[model samples]
Target: MKKKLIQYSDGYLNRVPILQFILVTLLFPLWGAAASLNEILITQFKVVFELSDFATAFVQSAFYGGYFLIAIPAATVIKKTSYRVAIIIGLLLYIIGCYLFFPASNMATYGMFLVAIFGIAIGLSFLETSANTYATMLGPKESATRRINLSQLFNPIGNIVGIILGKYFVFTDGASLESQLAGMTPAEAEVFSQEMLQRTLVPYQFILIILLVVLLMFLFVKFPKTKPETSKNVKNKVNLGETLKYLSKNNPFKKGILAQFIYMALQTTVWSFTIRLALEINPNINERFASNFMIYSFVAFFVGRLIANVLMTKFKPTFVLTIYGIIGVAALTYTAFVPNMTAVYGAIFVSVLFGPCWPTIYGRTLETVDDKYRETAGAILVMAIIGGAVGPVVQGFFSDMFGSLQLSFIIPMLFFLYLAIYFLSENKNDSHVKEESKIA
Candidate 1:
C-alpha cells in the first residue's frame, strides 16, 4: 500500500508524522495506568501495612526497578526486530502487569503488588525504548527537534489523566478528619481508613480494561516501518564499536548523559515521595486526596514542556536545558526546606523546568554525532534513564530507616548539582547570542 503522507509545520516534518503522533499519544493512558494506580497502591500500604516514607517510596522503586532488568534486553529486542514488534511486545507485558494487580490486591500481599508493578514496568521499558526511536525516525531527519517536541505531548497528557484517575480512586475524601474524630471511636476511624484505601480498586480496574483495549488496538494499527540494517548490511551501515568510540570521545555528550542520569535520579526520588510529603505539609491533607494534588504537580511538567516547545524556536536547546537544571537546583532546595502544601505544590511546578531536560540534554549530546549511529545512541540514552530506577531506590532506602522522605530528596539533588556543571560546560567560550543564532 502506498503510504499516506502529511506535512508538518517544519518543512522536514512532512509525510505521515500524524501516525507517530497517534502512537505516541497512547503513552498517555499507559503511563496514566502507572501514575493513577500509584495513589491507591501507596495509600493502601500506608494504611494497612503502616509504611514509612522510605518504605512507601518502595512502591515507585518497584515500578522503575523493571527498567533496570529490562533495559538492555529490550534494546536487544529492538535491534533485532522492528519498532512495531517491540511495542506490541511491550504493551502485552504491560497488560499482564495490570492483570497481575488483580491477584495481588485480592491476596492483599504487598509482595504480590510489587511483582505486578514490576511486570508492568518491564513492558514500559520496551515501550520507552521503541516509541522514542520511532518518534525520531518519523519525519525529516533534520527536523528531529520539532518532531520530538511534538511527540512529547503524550508525556504530560498521560500524566494528566493518570493524576485525575489516581486522585479519583484513592481519595475517598468524605467527612473531614475533625468531624470523624468528634463522632467516631478509635476503632471506627481505623475501619474507615481501611474502607477508604480499598476504594482504589474502582479506578485501577477501569484503567486496566482501557489498557487491554488499547493494546489490542495497536495490534491492528499499521505503524510505519523502520528497520535497522541487518546481517551484511549492518556492517556497511554502522559499526557499534566505532559508534562507542565516537560517543566516548565526545566530552560534552559524555558529561551530558551523566548529568541527565543524575538529574533524573534526583527528580524521580523527590517525586516518588511527593504523596507523603503532601500529607506532611497539611495535617488535614487527605492521603487519598494526595493523588489529586499530584495531578496539579504534574501540570507544571506538561505546561513547562509546552512552553519550551515554543521557546526552543527562539532559544538554543542546550541553553534551555542548562537553565532548567539550575532551576531544578532551586526547586529542589525549595521543596526540601518548605513545609507548606503551597510550597510543595509550587515545587512540583519545577517539572516544567525539568520537562525539557531529558530530550534537550539528549539532543545536545547527539549534536556532535553523525546521524547513522542514532539508534545505538538511543539505547545508551535509555540506559541513562535507568538512573531513575537506581536513584529512587537509594532514596527509598534512606526513607526506610530515616523519618523524613523530604530530606531523602536531597541525595538526588546532589546529582543535579553535577548536572549544572555539565550544562555550564555545554556552551563555554562562545557567546550565548551567537550560539542561539547559529542554531536558529
Candidate 2:
C-alpha cells in the first residue's frame, strides 16, 4: 500500500514540473505557520493589553474575518486571472501584513494589530483557495485525497515550528518581561510593556523577508498553464450565481462545506484557548509552561497527520475521517466534563484526531465536485473558515461567563459531533448514488 501510494505521488510529480511542484508545496507550511501564530497572539495579547477573554478572542475574529470577507473576491481574482497571479497577490498581502506589525506596535494599539492580522488572513484565504484547488488538479481522481494529505504533511511541521517560535520568543520572553515589570512603578511597567510589544515586530519582520523571497520565486516560476484534469468546459469567466445553482444540487459538497465549517470552528476554539484551559486545569502550569504544552499538542497533531497519511493509502479517506471524528467527539466531550489535568491531556488527544479532518474533507470535497466548479467550491469552503472567527469568541464568552475554561470545551464537542454526522451522511449518500447508477 505504502509503495503504491509513493508510486502515485511520484507519478504526479513526474507529470508536473518538479520545481513548480516544490514551490507550491513550500506554501503549505508558510500559511500553516501564519495561522498557528494566532495561538500565541491570543495568549500574549491577553497579557500585554490586559484584555478580557472575550476581547482577546477578537484576535481570531479579525484574523478569520478576513477569510470571510475576502475568499469570494479571491475566487473572482483566480477565476478571472490565473492561480499564479493569485498566489503572488496572496504573498504580497502577507508580507504587507507582517510589516504592518511594526507600525502597530509603535502605535501601541490593539486595533492596529488586528488590522494587520486581518490583512495577513486575507492573504491566507487566497493561498488556500489557489493551493488546495491546485493540489487536487495534480493527480488522478483515485489518489487526490492522498496527494493533498501528502502536501499537507508540512502544515503540522510548520505548526510545530510556529509553536516553538511562540514558546521561545513571544510567550516565554513576554512572561519573563512581565515578571520583571511586576516590581516596577506603573510608569516603568508601561515602558516595559511597550518594549515587550516591540518583540513581536522582529518575528513578523523576519516573516516578511521570507514571504518576499517566496513571492519572487513564484513570480519567476513557470506553472502548468492548464491541467488535463480540469474540464475544458470550465469558463475563464466563472459565474458565481451559476456556480451556486450547480452547487445547490451537490449534496455531498454541501455536507463537506458543513464539515469544514465545524472542523475549522472546533480547531480554532480548542487551540485559541489551550493556554487558558491549561492554566485553569493544571495548578503547576503557568503561561510559559502552558505554551510548551501547546507545542506538545502540535507534536501530537504532526504525528496524527503522519499516521493519517499512511492510513489514507490503506483505507477510504471518508472512512478515516469518520473514525477520527468519532474519537474527537469522545475526547472533547470528556474534556468538557472532567475539568482536570486528564481533561487537558484529552483536549490534546482530540487535537490529534482533528489533524486529518481538514485535508481529508477538502480532498473529498474536490473529488465530489465537478472540475469546472472546484476552484469556486474551494473558495466557498475557505470562506467557511469564518467559523474560526465565530467559534472562539463564542467559547470565550462562555468561559468568561461561567469562569470555567475547561467546561467551555462543550462548544467544540458539539462541532465534532456535527462532523461525525456529516461524514457518515456523506458516505451513505455516495453509496446510495453509486448503487442507483449500477442498477440503471
On lDDT, the candidate that comes out on top is 2
Instruction: List candidate 2 segments past 4 Å from native.
Output: 1-14, 173-184, 227-238, 433-440
Which is the leading candidate under TM-score? 2
lDDT of each: 0.68, 0.79
Can you write out model 2's per-residue Cα lDDT over 1-440, one digit (the tens) per residue?
A: 12222123122333444566678888988887888888888877877788888899999999899988888888888877877888999998888888789799899889999999998998888898888777755645555676677778778777777777767676553334345666889898888788767776766766777888899999987775433233334553347888999988998788778778888899999999887788777645556788777787888888898888788679766777778888888899898998568887888887678778888788777667765676688898888888899899999999889888788899999998889888777667768878999999
Score candidate 1 by lDDT.
0.68
lDDT of 1 by residue, 292-322 (tens): 6667667777788888888789986666766
Model 1 residue runs over 4 Å out of place are 1-14, 175-198, 228-234, 237-253, 366-373, 397-402, 429-440
Score every model by TM-score: 0.84, 0.90
